[model samples]
Target: MSAAEFSYKLRVYIEDTDAGGIVYYVNYLKFMERARTEFMRELGYGKDAIFNHGLMFVVRDMAVRYLRPAQLDDLLEATVRLIDLGGASMTLAQEVRRGAEVLATATVTVACVERAGVRPQRLPRDMTDSLRAARDTNGN
Candidate 1:
């Protein structure tokens, strides 16, 4: 990652909106999740790889604010940035923007846990280092 490492962009689809044509509030979380997945993919680790290690990522907490509304077919961009990474948990700052207008913002905390009992576990050292490097390089 670098100072310019912004998250990926994803266009909104009709299916992502509500009957009134505005994006459904819950879908913002979906967008954020996708951005996080892509962020990990860019780091050479996919969901399967993480799960194969008997580890799974779960949303521990989140705070979201909706500032504007997005309609179906809008080209929405979702950005995800690491805020903090601890031994077993990490926090992210995520946003959904339509061009210059920020539609929504969220701070999400995720924890690494064993898939079975959902017990918290330390993230792999290499993975943790990689996330830290991304955060550092991205100036997040």
Candidate 2:
């Protein structure tokens, strides 16, 4: 995959927040995860299709920074951008925002692995092709 940023829109709900009505810190990761999943889905790999191929993607590492607090009922957008794609791993940059305000940002690395043994595996050719096409369409 190349450097194409994708955005997913979501609304903060009660379940996403703390008793103080602010979104929990870890939930930002979840929001970014959702954006990445949607990005794959847009490339024609839905959740079931992704895992059903006998291989699945797993988070290998991540670093996050919290910038601001998001309140319950806030309309949010999460974004995913491919920073690098390797034979068996990919790095993504993500951000969660409430309108113009960024709440958090993360850099995540995920590895493609066999589901059964959890061993690293190369990404499928078709998936890679589709991602490349998307990147080109998005201007790189």
Candidate 3:
């Protein structure tokens, strides 16, 4: 798939922060996860479709870089772009930004697997087609 970008907006709340009032390091991953979910949802892969098909996507590998801290009540935008697609896996580039300032970035690889056995499986044809068709003119 081409680099099709998608974004999801979120607000940092107390529950997402540490005692120091900054977002916890792992919470950035959570933000990126939400962005990916939204991206798939827009591609017609909602909770039901994902969980009911006997297959689901699971993160296989991830690398994250935290650049800045986000404070409580900060409005953040999490972005996802498909950078690579394979028969059974896909890699995404993700970022969490506060307005124009990027706070974190990640490269995530996810694989499709059977829900019961968790064994890797090829991506569904329709899902791959939808991902290839996805586009965002305003993702910038």
Q: Residues 1-140, candidate 3: write the lDDT tens digits.
A: 33657889999999999999999999999999999999999888998998878888999999999999999999999999888889999889999999999999999999999999999999989988887666434343
The digit string of per-residue lDDT tens for model 2 on 1-140 reads 44667999999999999999999998998899899899999888997888888899999999999999999999999998888778998888899998889889999999999999999999999988877676667642
Candidate 3 accuracy as TM-score: 0.93
What's the TM-score of every candidate structure? Answer: 0.92, 0.93, 0.93
- Candidate 3 has an lDDT of 0.90
Give the 10-residue window scoring lowest on summed lDDT in candidate 2.
Answer: 131-140
Which residues of candidate 1, in runs, are more than 4 Å off?
1-5
> Model 1 Cα displacement at 56 (Å)?
0.3
Better structure of 2 and 3 per lDDT: 3
